[model samples]
Target: MKTLFILFFSIPLLSACSGGASKINGHPNIVYILADDMGYGDVSCFNENSQIHTTHMDRLADQGMIFTDAHSNSAVCTPTRYGVLTGRYAWRTRLKDGVLWSYDEHLIAPERMTVASLLKKKRYRTACIGKWHLGLDWEKDEEGRTLLTRPIKNGPNANGFDYFYGITASLDIPPYLYIENDRVTTVNIDTVEATSGKGFWRKGPIGDDFKHIEVLPRLTDKAVGFINTQSKQAEPFFLYFPLPAPHTPILPTNEFRGKSGTNTYGDFVLMVDDVVGQVMAALDQNGIKDNTLIIVTSDNGCSPLADYNELAEFGHDPSYIFRGHKADIFEGGHRVPFIARWPAKITAGSETDEIICLTDLMATCAAIVGVDLPDNAGEDSYNMLPVLMGEKIAHPIREATVHHSVNGSFSIRQGKWKLEFCPGSGGWSPPTPEVARQENLPPIQLYNLVEDIGETNNLTQQNQQIVENLTALMKKYISDGRSTPGSAQKNEGETPLMMD
Candidate 1:
């Protein structure tokens, strides 16, 4: 105990950001709970007028810091997840637009240092439970076959995790099945019909035990089980629980159905809250609550599958004051709810407006573990530990945060100035560039988010100098192959649409 305390305290705090809670040990159990396609306003704490009652998420807010200006690296599931694990923007990879679909090859390279892999190096038992939208190289029966075969070429297990229990992609994506470690638990493959609207799911192969409705509950149970099991062990563990819920097939269990008094999607959000509660309960039950750093956040904004129109009838706007929704270049697309709780290290019920991206998670964790990330790893990630500890800082943690849309549009934000290389929403939202062209919209857009949070006013024509400066920075970031200061590195693949 004395040794652990001494080692933990030996790392000096930033002089600017002084004072912090006394921690028990240097190593704390890290449970990163990522929600799929959940919007920023879905949480009651984030949105005062939210229709869905997210009690557990609200409770979590009361116990942690609420980041008013946090975002996923991209405005979609797979990309944001890629950024989360790798600390590099997904845009830097070959996939510049859209997401990896069913049976797509694994996104993470074998040699890449993933958050799990980094922790494993530190002797932390790592596990991933829930949705893995990042592609998996499933062992196939033939070259082009979609059928399941044993010994998946790569998955969460292959990347860095010692254990993996989850689906390969979104709940709606086909070939739905659960994988334990490197193998599918059961091969009793069956066909499922494609459905559309509210409870939508693609028609494809499904395992015998895999049910859309049972997935969330099953993941919750597995996460709780993992925590309980790991809590008894001496070595700390890292559990990456990414829930596949409130996305498509918005299945709120029978007890939760119609409970939100808004819509089925609202009901599903409620169910997601329950899942959060269960995980928190597990931590408390196992007596690891204080020493465990748990973060609950979404991959991106609320997907259109939630039926914004239907949700609005109940006086709900998942994007809240933000302009657009998922897959767009707007704040509504990438800006997401971010709350973190670490009783041992972080101040309670605090709030910060520090601009942060999901990609920053890697650097933050690396800082906590006292590991200096190599130049090759977390190239775009920024360490947010100083800000999280409530230390006063001279400037923003991120020099400028980059945002990407599903259609491959790019935007860069530094301070309040934002520059977008797109004329439209840049996703499945209003006035696509094609329509914007016909409507004679500007070829690009810029906004001072400080003056316009809704992104209502376009200041591109008026702010040419700011536009040029931002555009130049964006170009430099691209050519440099990284956002952070490091030796010049080559981007994995060609960046899509260099500039407008």
Candidate 2:
């Protein structure tokens, strides 16, 4: 493992590397702010009639490029997070369906190259702060209880990040203790019961200092401190700021409570917006705003726990015009508001409908630092640096994008067409797989997304050839163990991680 001091000492020599338009100062610092369970319609810029005005997020969009077609690789947290870090789809791994439990072992293979590891290769100091749902291997007692006594094995620190500070999983999950680096911030834990309704969470152990309402603010403060600490350093830093906000335990501070005038969920979103503002402010206060490449997006769509019906009563729809919420094989399930700002390269207030996935972070960063990725790494990543630089691309950057539902349903999108293998929503939404089957729906579904973005109409019967083509492409992606242009690589497991 090469240290930053060793690699960064030769920055002048490395600047000779080609590909990106690197500045004399150095490669731009990258700050990836990932919001958990925030929906496309939650942000005012993405949703015209949105009730919660995400002022900071909207300003970020105003200063950078807003990707209208950006999507998470999966409609869930763990898998989508895996894709973001590893630049590979999580479904290809053994944990086929659903999310990882708090007690589950760490997911990323030890040898895998992650965004943090790659950035560190370029002498960029990497740190991850906030929720890491990708699993952590914890020590256990003879009674089979989790013990956060020592440094976690194969945790974030082991996977490329120089520093790690955050919870193990969603706020709603149990054992609500903060982990800074590999050790617990505090060992004082008490059993806490699950809360019902909007502020819902499973019953679990919680540290004395861990308050549901304070988690968001604590994480934000930590991020600001990190930025302040890095301000004096010449070397650029990479902060993977993943927020566990507006997700669950919908705990909004008193100052933001009732701010949205909609509901607790709406208030929580406003708080999330405040978090973005705080991060941006930190950058500005530290004089790192202009050169920093700030990209903000969500892990997945809004969870139904947001109470859509209640939001509808306030004339606010979290999913916006899209059909379903999270965990479904619909546009809303995966499509998210992706905003990036980099004054050095990206045009201000620019917007592109260029289709992109979170997995692209790896290759884009690699391109920025002028590192050509080996075939084995970033298998599903596509470089959108050109699109970010206002380049007029003649063809789509991706041959087609793949989406996965919580139930492991597969959907492939190319241009305007989207095909799903499951019979229905394939998740929590109505017309579930069972319902669709009972209603005699076809085993597969095809939609012309361009003509019918809502996906209300099924064109499977009329477009057999298109369906076949997409199916074949999906199969090739599976058999070849990758979607991007590369030599055939084997998947981690025997199961194909897809439906016909």
lDDT of 2 at 449: 76
* lDDT of every model, 2 decimals: 0.81, 0.83
lDDT of 2 by residue, 1-500 (tens): 00000001112223423222233457666777888888999989999999888888888888888889988999988999899999999888987779998889989999999989988887788999988888889988899876766668888998999999999888889879999998888868888888998788999888888888888899889988987887557777778888888888888989998999999999988988888888888777765565567778888889998999999999899889998889998988999888878776789998898899888888887887889989899999999889987988999999999999988899999989999988889888989877887898878888887889999888989999998999999999989989999898888777453454
Residue by residue across 7-66, what tens digits does model 1's lDDT show? 011122223132222222446667788888788888889999988888988887798778
**Model 1 Cα displacement at 433 (Å)?**
2.8
Candidate 2: C-alpha RMSD to true structure equals: 4.9
In terms of lDDT, model 2 sits at: 0.83
Please name the candidate that would achieve the greatest lDDT relative to the true structure.
2
Clashes of each: 2, 0
Model 2: CA > 4 A from native: 1-25, 497-500
